[model samples]
Target: MIGDEVQVAFTKYDGSPHWHIGTRLLGEDEHGTWLHSPAGTFTWRPGLAFTYDRANVLCVPRGQHWAATLYDGGGASAVTTYVDITTPAVWSAGRVTMSDLDLDVVQRVGEEPFVDDEDEFELHRVRYAYPPELQAQARAASAAVLAAVTARQAPFDGATAARWLALAEPAWTPVAPPARPAG
Candidate 1:
């Protein structure tokens, strides 16, 4: 439902926790389900946590193996967009979870978009014992996302994200970083 809070979680291929963040459901379109993580949203992993200094929109395309995060521009960080090649998202009880494939497509301001984290992907492939089919699927998803983002394709293009961002701004509530959980 639009305006509802949702938890987004990512796990490694070996099922280790990766990133987990809280976001607001920003409605869906032909592209996919859109989520808004406004500035100050808390994102954390096993040993790291931080608050976002800029707003971003997350798109998890239906039946797609990739998810994209579109950032607000003009920040010190050059990253304008980041796409994670992952297993298709599974939603349950107001949460969405997916397995991060360790491959990413990044678009930086004033630079050509490129696939990042090949080394990490290769390392995890061995460590996690990814099956041949899974490896091939991850590679294919990376390639497809790279092309779409590079070509400014719909949902990859800032326009679609911008519209969603605007809708979220009015209802945005500030989020503080959560206290680190005790070991």
Candidate 2:
């Protein structure tokens, strides 16, 4: 049974057009008809393609720049298992890679703002603003993490990757959910 939804946003190479890539979800309605989110209510139609198959352009694979997060009717978080549509319009045999993604912690924890003369500050409860440099570092770190997983065909180590990425990009924030209600 489909449990959750994965949303990915992708833009063209030249920064022109963009579209969303969404995962298919299976749910039972109050009336017992199987309803598919993003596709509206529908029953078995033998020859008709499934929602996911019809929205094949959205899935991106390794090497593609994309923002992705998963929702469990709750909120967004890092994703692990995802349908890979990473290959360009040439490949025919599509596959899903179950590599773990380790979210970077520094990005998770964010950055600390320090006063010019202040040497020490409170440890845990401190609230600070992330500088622009930090945010860039974080993005670079994220790219590195993606590269590694692609090379090793493994999941990212969340804490380390997050920390490294956070070092560069202080503006590490998780993807925000769309304002529209989930279907």
**Model 1 C-alpha lDDT per residue in residues 14-118, reported as the tens digit of each score:** 777888888889998999999989887889989888778888999998888998999986456788899999999999877889999999999998899999999
Residues 124-181 of candidate 2 have per-residue lDDT tens digits of 0123332445334434545553455444322223332232222222222222222332
Q: Which parts of model 2 have CA positions greater than 4 angstroms off? A: 1-18, 25-131, 156-183
Best by lDDT: 1
lDDT of 2 at 26: 33
Poorest 10 consecutive residues by lDDT, candidate 1: 173-182
In model 2, the Cα lDDT at residue 16 comes to 24
Each prediction's Cα lDDT score?
A: 0.87, 0.27
**Per-residue error at 70 for model 1, in Å?**
0.5
